[model samples]
Target chain A: MQRTIVFDVLNNDNGQVKAILGAKRFIEENPEYKLILVGQEEVIKNTLGKYAEKVEIISSNEIAHKVISPRDALRNQSSMLSAFNVLKEGKADAILSSGDSGSYITLASLKVKRLPNVSRPAFMPVLPTTTDKKMLLLDAGANLEIKAEYLNEWAKIASEFHKIIFKSNKPVVGQLNIGTEDYKGTEIAREANKLLKEQADNYSFKGFVEPSSAINGDVDILVADGYAGNIFLKTLESSFLGFAKLLKQIYMRNLKTKISALMIKKDLKGFKAKFDYRNTGGAYIVGLDKVVVKAHGGSDEVAFYNALNQIKIALDNNVIEKLKEVFEQAKEGEDE
Target chain B: MQRTIVFDVLNNDNGQVKAILGAKRFIEENPEYKLILVGQEEVIKNTLGKYAEKVEIISSNEIAHKVISPRDALRNQSSMLSAFNVLKEGKADAILSSGDSGSYITLASLKVKRLPNVSRPAFMPVLPTTTDKKMLLLDAGANLEIKAEYLNEWAKIASEFHKIIFKSNKPVVGQLNIGTEDYKGTEIAREANKLLKEQADNYSFKGFVEPSSAINGDVDILVADGYAGNIFLKTLESSFLGFAKLLKQIYMRNLKTKISALMIKKDLKGFKAKFDYRNTGGAYIVGLDKVVVKAHGGSDEVAFYNALNQIKIALDNNVIEKLKEVFEQAKEGEDE
Candidate 1:
């Protein structure tokens, strides 16, 4: 059986032609997957050449209109909304976008709707750790003002998502905080801790985890409000990039150092690849009725291809169906 | 012009003997400065040997008693508290402690008291950036719950501190947020942004800065609530250590890489030093009536000595008196 994946090829830094070519390559690699390119038909055909014939085109004149900013994107619907409409109509198994995340999230929530019993949707991204395993950081930047219940829901959603994606039967969920102590953090954190403890039967609750522990692979999933989670993720990213930049400066210091750098260039490249966000595809907009993966806005061809691969994985593994079943069961238990 | 500095040689990982030696060396190098060692008399005398005669000892048997954790340190009065008492009584010009930060902060706030009209005290630490200039990150981990007013006060205090220390006429203050957009974050952030904007006359308001911009030195002072600030600081520290560990593993993979590593070992050490918190001494407990510096609990001899050096600078520069005058003038203006 083939699955249709909608690719939003607008507002990305790589330009529409490059994104369409990336999507065409993805379709060629995976015979079981098909693409619906949502952008200008003439531009897609001209850039993709022979490959454009394979993908279904959803033409939109608004694709080239400047969004001004993320705030502007959020206030008005862009061409990316056309992509989500296809997903909502059951024409696509999953949707991938490299546009404004805030706008995509808002449009997805309004158009596709939320899962049963879920008050808020979250952005769950897999982060590479020092160990062989990867950690899931949730609520990356969806809801700014989060209640205790939202964190509890995120933990549950992430745990199931982890099980489906990573094949872990029982994943440990850690709430992000300033300290690992039970009594640490704000009023919302303490309340969420209690709720998570009570629901330990559903998932393994690992009390509190600081930002360092989250990066060190202390737990399978780390959950937090969008504000703290965003800061934590951005800090880790910036620090990694900062160190890389410093190393480049050192490597280029003199002729002697440049020779030494060349001696270990292969090893350094491998190390840099481990911290690259492009390799991880993009974050999943969890708790949505349909599958939506947000690729980096500045994504290149390689990054866009990985994001398309992620959607293929999600569709193959029945992630959306499994998530819906879990929430439905929980609601049934509450009703009884 | 000489300053009397009290060193709290308790709760540090280097034990009393090693801490005493570090302090002894600091006093010997600076003939104009005097020392007051706060610890058990027997341990101080036994460790000091010949240096014992030159310094004063404020003995406390409770110095050897285990503090257990930061929470335990917060509840009881320890030897570090005895040192704070000395500073409160005007016996020492400044105080430096290498113990549990929460306990030190609690004792300092209780004994030394806060400056008039200051609701909460904060920890302000200098972090090295890619640029030649260093950045001041405040409220590193003091109050868990912060209001817009607290941020307003932090900007005012940090601006004054920056003007005195860095000799800048006006410092630019950046509030840490998820985005630089005007309508990006929570209500707290929105309110604080408005307050910071209104007070642009007193200091240069750089607007909201993401975690990456903060580390890259987009502004002179980065202000955030303790919860978010601690996470940001800890994430940077952990990420730097993680990358260093990864590089070491890569370098030690083969004989060829090992030789390359040895060739760049000196440059690597220098690069690592720029990100070291120990080199910056420790974070200062700002908004207090007196000078109090909190060194890392696991600080070694060199780190402890640098912390003491920080105290000496604080005292010699009349930081306390200047801060008091600033607050007093502000209060007078408010009364009118």
Candidate 2:
């Protein structure tokens, strides 16, 4: 079976040519997959070379500029919007973009039908943790205001994806809060905590977790209101980057330290590799019918290639189909 | 100009004996100051030695256990409560304790009156950044629910303290949000953003900032609602600690990296010292009548010594009195 991915090859910082480079490499490796390249038609054809004859290209030079309102995304005639249109028309099995997150989330939510029982979609990203296992953090910045039911809904959907992505039988789900105590956070967090506990049969529920829990890799699927989750994600990213920069300064201090750095450069490289964005690919714009992913804005050819593979992993495991089955079955039971 | 500090030498994880050791050192160094030690009388006298003759000891063996409600702290007969009472009755210039945070906050706010025009108190900690400067982060978990005014109120009070502590006349202030965009985050965040911008004369306001701003030391005082501020603080600390642990694992993997680690051991120690809790000493429970500082739970002699010095800087600078004058003068203007 051939799977087609709608690749929005414009709006990324690195330019369309590099994105096209990524697409060409992706097609060469995965012969069974089809590509729907949406960007400058001439550039796409020119860069793709030998693979140009195989993949379909949509001529769209207009890139989606970051917009304040979600409604504005639908009205735009940008390449990102055009790509979403292709996915909406069922011309592709999955969609990937390195466009503006706000616009991408808007288009994904508006164009793609929600999975059964999912009221609002969440931004889910598989993040590297201290442990060998990767952790899935959701609502990374999509919904700032959420209700208690949203947590329960997102948890049920995310747990299914966690099982597929991490291959864990019963992934531990934790609600991010200011503290682990029962009465530690806002009313919404506490309310969500009680709601998650009641219907937590499908996965393991860790009532409330603090930032240390995320750092220690104490939970598998960490769910939070978009505000806290997004801040946590950004803080974690910037802290690690900042720490690495500081570490670099230490190693470059003097000849003695510089020699010490050279002596163990390979091990340091290996440590750095653990945090490579290539490994995690991009964040999944989850709870939609299609396998929609938002690639990093600064993604290079290698990053895009890995992101395409990430979407492939989701499609191969039939994660959306599995989630639909579970939620639909639960609905049927309630109706009965 | 003799000053007295009601030292609550209990409820810390390190035990009362360690706290007494810290107080003993503090009293020895600062001969002009008096310590109203609240703990087992025999232990306080026995440990303080020569300094015991100079200081006052409030005999209270019970430690302030963590409480669910603010009212519960008022009812407790713990040494922390006794210490608060000492500050309450105009017996001490300031107070220090390594007690339960919630309980301490409750006692501090209830026992000590709020500064003029100050509606609520906040937790302010001096945090280390990559730059040589230290940052002041407030509302670190005191108010989970906040209005637009709380941020402005906290900012004014924190700015005064920042000036006293860091000796910066025009410290840069920033509001921590999900994003720096004007349109991002909740209604309160946007409203607070506007409110802060309007009355940001005391300190240089940097509108909205992300976690990177804090990590890079781009701002001096980062203000937020208790929930977000607390999460950011915890995440920043745990991330630094987590990275260190990971770095340690890398160094211990083999003999070569181990030798390299030894070669750069002193530099690493210097880096670690930059984040020592002992140096920052403790978190100041701001917006109160007196200088109320809650020391780190695991504080040793040096940490306690530094925390005492932190209080001295505040008292010596007359931060609380200066804040009172500023707010009172502002209130009088509003009435006129």
Candidate 3:
């Protein structure tokens, strides 16, 4: 299949550099794939250098920054919208961004085409876990609040992705809660458990999983609402930093400890490498018609390389095509 | 000062045996303190054994498990409430429990007492950073939904405790949010930032902290609502386990890695010790009239010993008295 990946550059940040580099690499490696970079004219040209022909400057004045609220994206004729417009017009196969996640999500959902039967699209980040692997946590920050039924849908969607990408025959899907029991969480958890139990064949429906076990690679798909998922992601990010900071403090204490640290730098590096989010590709806003992936705000060149690889994974797995089929199947089953 | 510590056990699993040992040690160390063990006749007798004279067993049919919900504690008249009654009658200076955290907090608040100028009590857990040094995080699992104003109060309360115990001249208090800036987070964060800015002296209110950087050991007091804090605590707990699991998996990958792991067992042990929650004592229910600490549900003998040490710290610091003084001072300032 031919691949045409576009970067909707709302600002001149590390994301833009990454998208361009990733696109260039993709074209060089895959021959059949085309890469397009869209942003301000002078900025895109300057960033692309000799590869300026492959990159397209759409010339967008609307800027989306961390300060810019999601509502602002709706009012402004932003680059974000322009990038999605290209996708809608079949100019690009997918859009990858490391910009404002909220604004981009809102723009993609409203302006870009949404897949049928997806009431709310989820920004799912496949986070690395301590169990020497990773799990796909859905709705990392898409919907603020979640319902049990919606969570059921999230479980199905995430499970399908796991089966398609990871090739798990019956990927285990667990609901994120405080405890691992049928009646562990608040009202939503209990109801979701009931719904998952009824459709046990399609999903593993592994009851409740505590936060500690959720990222242990014990489950393939972890389902949570946007609010909880966002908190989870931020907390995980903070905890890694906290642990790193603590280690740095201990190593810096006096001359004796500093010597001990030098002896273990290799071990510490191995540890740090395990939790580095940059190695993982951008998070996908699943349940959209076209592939939309959100990169980290502080993503560097290497991280963009990871994102490019992830886009291929999504493309090869037929993420969009599988989603449409599953949602339609769910609806048809419900109608019966 | 004369100290009378009460231990109530009904339906407790080996609690009487543990409490008896703990009581005997305390009596042997500090002759000024008295130990009152409240539980069943035969079980308490068996636990008391040779130290039966030092331990006083008051007959009570109340059992509090970590799994028991608040409603069960409320409905079971003899269980948690009866233990609280022991504290109310001036029989005990503090109540120590290896039981449920929720029950301990609720019973301690409604039955024993509620502190002045405090609407709801909160649990403050000290978490270790990577360097193995610990920082205090408040509302670990007490208040589910709280406003920015409540966060300000929580910060104040946490600051006072840290000041008294940790003896930091100017305790830095930070509101946990998604990012560090003048403007960020949900509406609650914005309001809390405004209040914290005004009372900079009383607290070293260090604007906002990103979730990733919040537990960096730089901030003396980290404050948030219970729900978010609980999730944060859980995530931290899980991430550590995840890292450990991943390391173990890497070690088991082949013979060469297993040999490297064998050489690093001592270093790994040191690293694991730093992440141990048992070293940080137990969580204290702040904004309460009396100091009540909740041990981890799966706490062993070592954790209980830490809880005892925490009780000592609270009493020595006079946290409850300091809270009264703070409330009065704030009230007077408001009135003026």
Candidate 4:
């Protein structure tokens, strides 16, 4: 059976050229899956060349810009919306975009159908930790004010994604909080912590964890209300970026420092690879019926290729199909 | 006039020995000021020696351990509580503690009276940026949920402190959000953003800022609701710590890397000094009538000395006194 992904190869911060190149690479490498490319008809067709015959192309020249309201985002007939429409019409198995997250999330929640027993969809991004493992952080921005039930539900979906995506038997789930103590955090956090502990069948619940634990890779899935989670994600990214910038300045200070940098160039590259966003692919909008991944806005050829491959893994393993069955059965059990 | 600070020398994560040494150093350096030390009397007295005669030592063997309830924190006869009682009784002009933040905040809110026109006290910490100038972040786990009015009030208080501490005539104030976009974040956040812009009277208000702007030191005072602010602070601190740890591992990998390390040792030391917590001192419990600072739990002698210095600067410049007058006038205006 052939799988398909609706690729919104436009509205990227660096322009559509890199996204087009990434799509071409993915198509050339993976013959089992195809992409319905949504972008400027001429550029994508001209770029894909031989691979053009292998996939479908939706003519969409309009790029999605940051809008003032949710209504504006929905009303705009952009490539991102076109991709979502394709996915909503069941024309593809998944959707990928490097567009602004605000509109992407708005479209995901509006267009994508929720899985059984799923209250709200969450933005779950695969993150690189200090260790060899990669972790998942959910509700990073999709729903700032979330209920306790929403967290527990997201945790289950995120853990399923983690177990299949990362090849873990049972992912360790943790609620991101100021402290690990039960007495800390808001009422919603405490309630979610209690619920996760009571229902730890899917994953090994690690209780409430601090941001340090998430960075150290102590848990597989770190859940929080969208506001705190987004703050954590952004700060973690900027701090590393800031630190690397300082390190570069230090190495480029003078001839002696530049030579010192040359001595450990290979090792430094390894360290850089560990924290690079490109290798990890993109953020997934979980709890939806189909795989909805949002690539980085500035994603290059390598990053987009990795993102498509990320979708391929989730599709090949039938993680979404498995989740549908699990959720449906749980709903049935509850009704009984 | 001689000034005094109720120093809770017990409850340090490292131990009371370092706190005593730090006190001795501060007292030696400043003949006009004194610390009403609250800790194991024998140990503090022996460590202080001649300096012990200069400062007041209150015998308190009970260390403030982590308690389950707010009632327990206040009811317990620990050194922290004892120190707070002494401060509340007007025996000292300030208070300093390197204890657990949870109980400390609980005590500060309950024991310490708010300044006139102040709704709530906020936890403000001076943070190091990539640049030379330090920035202040407030409500870092002090009040997780807040109104827009609280943010506006905090901005006024934080700016006053920033001006005196950073010696900036007009500090640049920015409210930290997930994004700089106006249409983003919670209602309170958006409202606060508008309020800050409208009332850019005291300081040069720079609307809403992202975590990146804070790290780059684009704003002098980065304000946010306690939940988001805390998440940002924790993530930033841990990421830098994590990066530093990775860098150390790379340099200690082999003899070649070790030699490479020595070549850049001077530059690396400069980078380390910039991010070190000891230099930045401690977090201020702002909006209180008296100057209250919370040092890092694992603070050593140098860190304690810096924290004392931080308090001294606040006291010497009469920042608290000025704020009292300003807030009192505002209250009177509001009454009119």
Candidate 5:
């Protein structure tokens, strides 16, 4: 089950240094995975000292920290592109970047290309389960305009990935919308529901699901377009912050409240940990010819290390190949 | 100012009886507001008992509840229609209903009519503040499709309302959008920003405000279309519940956690109190000729009573008249 994976590190924020250190530490522990850190030569080398000899650093300051547009990746010829090149050269399994998501998708699609029969690449993050491990949510902010057929494909792809990676026997794929009822969404969602139901034998279609359902581990795979999914994820993130801020206000209210804070400090930490995006790692841009993961903007070493771990599993399972097979079969079935 | 106001209370769910009882208590404490409990004669009498005499219970078993559409109010014999008749007759200063919001808006608009120069009615709710106190968030779910001109009017009306209600000298009006940048939102929002800026003398037109900014209490009046506002309100409600649930799970994890929960239980209660929507009166359907409030669907008796309290204030201030005056002044300024 052990697999070797390359880390395409982009020098953007402090997250890059953290990611480098995380990948090195992970490689040191699991000698099966080889580490390739790509960014500013001196910066990557300085941050990654002892493991510096073991890790390979690809240098290119072409790409700046914060990419303004997807066009910038093509025009600027930045570090992100250099790391992407490594994947194109077959030297690395997949590229993981904490840089601009739009740029990541743009570069991966134009350079790495799409799997046969795939229209658009979808970014899916595994949201940590409130009780158990995690659930994968797709189109977090990748595919803007998606068809019913595309969602069906996403459902199939995510189902196979969940079963293979998470080891779920029969992964439940739920189409997300404003409501769970059949006729509760926009024209696209409603149409998608009908189409997905017709091909229920191909995948486990759990009907429609609401935004609240996504957080509760109701389904193994939650599907939606980028807009709704973006709002869903951002809301979760902000809500976590809101609750944290509220807790701080309560504890800092007065001397009595401060004294009481000691008692529930551990409990509060446990509560906050459930919403920690860091533990889950970066979202994989699924339905692509080659694997690409978009790490969180504020990701630390642990999160980056986790992304590297994700890359290894994704590579070993040949997710892209499995997805391609599903796409072909699904398309043939549709035509018939 | 001691004022006598009547409530056309609609008993929709099991909590209706309690809500009525809470209003009765408030009526007794204030003696300023009289209770007009409208519904089935038998149920109202059974619930209120001796206090039923004080409350003028007009018999109408055919009360439109959740199952009934807002259009059902158009039916002559419906209880909701009968309640509006009371307001029309000057029997009630302001009508408060905990029934379906859509039905309330539909009937209230027809019965009360729109304020002069106001093309569409708006509903504004006082969202719970993360700051020192709460602020008004307009069109919370009133008008779905609003023009730039309508938003400009909304700002003026909201500013005047805030001055009378919240007592802000120069009420800060902000158009809600994704970001604060010059060109962050849709065409409607961008134009609203422009219009608001032009009329800065009337409304302290702040720049675009984010969802977090609304909660952060940076502005007095936050205006947006119903669709976005509905999503925003629901997001906040769902998030509060989700976070509370997470905290409960953490505290009940083990004996140690339970012990910690006991220590912070008081502070946690205080923290949650900040978000208790029950304290604030129900949402006001603004721009209507007559004053109307939409109490929370799951609101208890205390919340209902709080809503009834606002009825008298709305009546005394003659919010409808003030809204008309504001609109006239705006038109005059345009003429000049």
Candidate 6:
């Protein structure tokens, strides 16, 4: 049976037409998957051309006009709401978007709703460490002001998400902080640390993991408030880019170094790929009723394909169903 | 013409005797500068042997016993207080310590006091970016809770420090945040951004700088609350260490890669030196009445020497006096 995957393509860096057309090959390759393009009908027909007939189109006039910022995108929410409505009405199995993340989250939470006992959904992205391991960082940018209870809930959600996705038992959860000491962060972190410790039987709670150690890839899941988590993610991205730029300058210094660079070009590519965010497809908005993957706004064709594959995995694995069961069991235990 | 530098050696990672012995060569080389060792008398004699006579000693049994953590170091501050007392009595020009930073900061602020109109002092460290540029990051770990007013004053202090150290006429100051947008951070960051904008005439305010962009060497000064600033510094350190480990694994993979690594050993060393924290010495405690450089607890002999050189530069430039003059003028403006 072919499962339908709806992609919102209104607010990406590349125009809607380009982003939609770029996904043509992905739709063609995944014949078992049904592609539903949700945006302006005329533009989809004009840009998608003959292939427009191969995929379903959900026309939306509300988001046709340009939105200047994420805040603006949230105000005009026609396309996102329509796409999410497809999932709400059982017409689609999953939703993928490269548009404004804040808008996607806001719309999804309103229309799709959260799982039982979950206050807010977190943006969980899997980032590759220097080693062979990959760690899931949560609350990447979903909520600005996070309470200790939010971090506590995020930990439980992330642990379940990792187990289902990575098939890991007893995953280590660490609270992100400036230092590894138990007493080394803001008031929220301190309170969260205590909560994590109390729930040690549920998950393996590692003490505070510094930002630097977090990248080393030892911990299974790193939890933080949106502000700190977003800063850490951006800093890692910038550092890798900066380092790549430095390597380019070094290799291009003289003909001798250029020859050396050419000799080890294959090895260098493998090394660089380990730090590329595109390889992970996209960050998942966990704790939601439906699977929502927010692909990077600047994603290319290949990156977009990877993001689609991520949704396929989530739907196939029944991740949300499993999480709901876990939360319900925990709620019942508390009631007892 | 001679200036006396008091070195506190009680709570360093290496024992007090070993740290004192490590600086013997520095004392011998700088014949014009007097070295005052502040520690237990018996320990100094046991370590210095014959050369103990050449250097002055300020013995204190108060810090003879062991102190375990930074909190403990703060409470047991005999050696630190003794060293600061030398500065207070007009007997020493500068003070250097490798003990607990919290202890050093607390003792310095209490005895030395802050400059006029300065509410809180900051720990400003110079770090090298990917480029040839070096940046000053303030409130590195000085205050756990920072107000917007502190950031405003720290910017003024950093601008003056940059002028004296880097010889820049107008230093570009950037507020550290998760994003560069005006509406992209916490309430404190939003307020600080406005304050920085208003004081644009005092310095070249470059607006908010992301942690990633901050390390690219574009801005002269990067300011943040203690929590974010400390995390950024630690993350950079951890990332560099992680990258180096990855490179080692890559180079040691096979004989061919090993041969290639040998060919670029010199180039790699130069590249690594550019990001070395030791090259810029230790971080300075700015806005204090006297010069205090908190050298790294694990600093080697060479790193300690560089830290001493930093103090020499600050003294020669009369940084504290210049900062007082600037703050006094600003106070007058506020009154008017």
Write down the TM-score of every candidate.
Answer: 0.95, 0.98, 0.86, 0.98, 0.86, 0.91
Pairs with steric clashes in candidate 5: A62-A78, A63-A78, B19-B301
Candidate 6 residues lying further than 4 Å off, grouped into runs, are: A14-22, A25-32, A39-54, A60-71, A77-82, A85-90, B10-32, B39-54, B60-71, B88-90
True contacts kept of 5: 0.25
Candidate 3 lDDT over B46-78, as tens digits, reads: 765776677666887656644356676667655
TM-score of chain A of each: 0.93, 0.97, 0.91, 0.98, 0.91, 0.89
CAPRI grade of model 4 = high
What CAPRI grade goes to candidate 1? Answer: medium
Runs in model 1 deviating more than 4 A are: A61-77, B63-77
**Candidate 4: segments with Cα more than 4 A from true spot:** none
lDDT of 4 at A62: 89
TM-score of candidate 4 to 2 decimals? 0.98
Predictions' DockQ, in order: 0.68, 0.87, 0.37, 0.84, 0.32, 0.56
How high is the lDDT of residue B220 in model 4?
Answer: 91
Q: TM-score of chain A, model 5?
A: 0.91
Q: What share of the true interface contacts does candidate 2 keep?
A: 0.88
What is candidate 1's lDDT per residue for A168-198, written digit by digit as tens? 9999899999887776788888999999989
Local lDDT at B76 for model 1: 64
Chain B of candidate 5 versus the native chain B: what TM-score?
0.91
Candidate 4 vs candidate 5, lDDT winner: 4
Error of 1 at B109 (Å): 2.0
Best by lDDT: 4
Q: Which CAPRI level is candidate 3? A: acceptable
lDDT of each: 0.82, 0.89, 0.72, 0.90, 0.73, 0.80
Expressed as tens digits, the lDDT of each residue in A1-336 for candidate 5 is: 434354556644664678777777787777766667777788788877787887778886664443445676677777777888787877776788888666787778767767778777788888864557578888776764578878877787788789777877778888776556674556788899998787765457889876566667778888887655654666566666777887888778887667667766766765667678787778888877777888887788888888877877777788877778887886797699
Identify the leading candidate in terms of DockQ: 2
What docking grade does candidate 6 earn?
medium
By DockQ, the candidates rank as 2, 4, 1, 6, 3, 5
Worst 10 residues of 2 chain B by lDDT: B20-29
Q: How accurate is candidate 6 locally (lDDT)?
A: 0.80
